[model samples]
Target: MRLLVSFLLAGLITDGEAQNWHGPHPWRANAVVDGRARDYNNEYFLHAFSYRHLIDRPSPIEEGIRGTAGSLTSDRLYMDFRYQQSFAFDDPDQAFTLDIQRAEDFDGSYDRQLVGFRQTLAQRWQLSLQGDVFSDKSLTDIYFGARRLHSEGSWLQLSLVLPNAYFNDKTDSQSELIDEPRTLFAQWHQQHTPWASTTLSVNHTPDATLDDRTQGDRVSSRQTRVALRYREQKGNWQLQTDLNGEHTRRQHQLDERPAPQAFRRDMASLTLAVRYWPHRWQPQVGARYFWLDEDGWFGREPNGNGEVSRQEPMLFGGMSLSLSDTQRLAPTVYLSRPRVEQTVNSPRWRDRDDHGFVGKLSVPWHITVSKQNGAVLSIVPSMRLHRFAFGGGNVQLHWPL
Candidate 1:
């Protein structure tokens, strides 16, 4: 489960060139209708690149991976690039990521490297910094962050994560694991008019970290979250709603327990969505509910009977077809049912409800109607069907690189 990989990074260059400027539309509505660059998204394409390939067999996790990424934006330099490599017939692993934002912000066989930045302070506070160096320094990582923006759709952010988590740990196999993560993000939105809208959010991470090298213990974890969202449109119908809550704390250490086990996790979720465009066709429906309440020690006040608990119910539907203006087609379906209720000395609890249903299809094509230098190319094909007889498909080609 920890076979990580990465290809090239760090002001990279060595027979693997050309990687950024933007627009690789594999979806997201075909990159908002063919990377709609509102006229040179402010001096566009200084650099942008991509190349990707992936194959996954969803019946016992067969795997393959390849990735490459590039990006560059200026006015103050910004690049968000990444690389990934992974494989399996047994074991293989890799990782990579590089980012520099406010300027704005890949690939297999790649080893590892990450660099990040985002700075802006007089015109509405902002600060960001990232790091992840490799060549095996235990695959280090330490990120930085800050943010602020107010006026109408307010904003605030915070990020700090130290990753290198999990690569070895089956109670000791040259134990290695890392997780010192932090996050605090905020948002606010309002539009009591034009249609209807309101959103409020908060995501908090209580400095979590756990480095237990089989007893060289250093455990700590705490998570947080809060959310509220609402949206509406009228005249074709479109609406969305969400409410979320999460809190988790985990501290564990065992080599025959010498006092070092504290666990607590709780989650709550709710979502509702509805859509109905109708011209180019679009029909959607959604419903979601999730809850997990259990875990002992550390102020044990969850009363959902602990050891661990879970309850999930979900259903979603979708359809979209806009076979023109850059071609499009989408289909989606989802269903989930989860129930654990509680577990302490459990044995899969006899499959815990094991509910299922999944189906997806997407076809996006934008064979440029004409445009050379500002690069544009897209082709997306994806398929998924899983229930009893699982299925899978993939085809992606995003130009540049």
Candidate 2:
């Protein structure tokens, strides 16, 4: 992820806009004139960065053009397979389970399969094994866990996650997989009452350096994350909130670079959502705040160290209006103001600064078909205009199984 940031920074310093000698980095002008000019790819990088950092995307975009959900109405077909079952023994105290799920996206973005098995050793105790198989075998993962039910409505889980668990997979070096560290995961969930519940989870990955043979680089990283979630239902309203924080330190050694580069990043986020479920209108509201700070050497050059900071707060509001006994229209709007700043040499030189208030509006029409097992099919088509000029339009389809 930081690699993209480094490339973007390089583009900013080499683009045509930086040719003038008005800025402090007058030396960059010579570099730009000496054949290190940025080409048309600069716009692509800027849009990609903006889409990830600033835009409130409504759905996943495939190949920078089409939305995943919107593609359902097109000629292409996509499908997912899922199967799960539990087997009981004569002892009545022992049982076995099998699970399999595969997602096949037409765009080849989420092509993966999960196979898992669980066995009950004793009452209220179970053990499980799960594996994730990705299109790239080097990215596979495996988990071995045990779950204990402490009470009627509470449980605890502990697991060991083996990152890049695949070995001798013809695709990558076996030594790189063997050197990856095993991550630790723990979670606790409790139900206080019929209407309220809470959950806490923690994950930690110790420092380790592994050869990314596929990319011809070396990465050393350590990360820890803690999160909590709360959900409750009171009267005619339902509420859910989440809080999480993470710290990460990473260093990268490119094959072409002689020196190693490193960075540290800290992030925190809060979210709250409320819905008046029992009301006719079914109004909903939610808000989220996220902040991040990163400082480190992002480029191959030693002098390419920098700091990046971002803060984003967003609000969401929506309601459902019944059009008929079998039809409804739900429209939701999102408003956000995101601020970002990037500087090199501490606070001495500013590289990029941007802040803006943007919004997105979505209106979806829901249709119920009783013959199709009362399935709810939603067709969402949206268009926008600014200053009497057409901006753009999009369409999406949703059908639940």
Off by over 4 Å in 1: 1-185, 188-193, 196-200, 208-221, 226-230, 236-238, 243-247, 252-257, 264-270, 275-286, 293-306, 314-338, 344-401
Report the CA-based lDDT of candidate 1 relative to the real structure. 0.39
Model 2 Cα lDDT, one tens digit per residue, 371-392: 3433344555432211232212
Model 2 quality (TM-score): 0.64
Highest TM-score against the true fold, candidate? 2
| Residue 277 of model 2, lDDT score | 71
The true-versus-predicted C-alpha distance at residue 40 of model 1, in Å, is 55
Alpha carbon lDDT of each predicted model:
0.39, 0.50
C-alpha lDDT (0 to 100) for residue 181 of candidate 2: 64
* Model 2 misplaced regions, further than 4 Å: 1-112, 133-140, 150-152, 166-179, 295-307, 324-327, 342-352, 366-378, 382-401
Q: Provide the TM-score for each candidate, comma-separated.
A: 0.29, 0.64
Local lDDT at 323 for model 1: 64
**How many clashing pairs does model 2 include?**
0
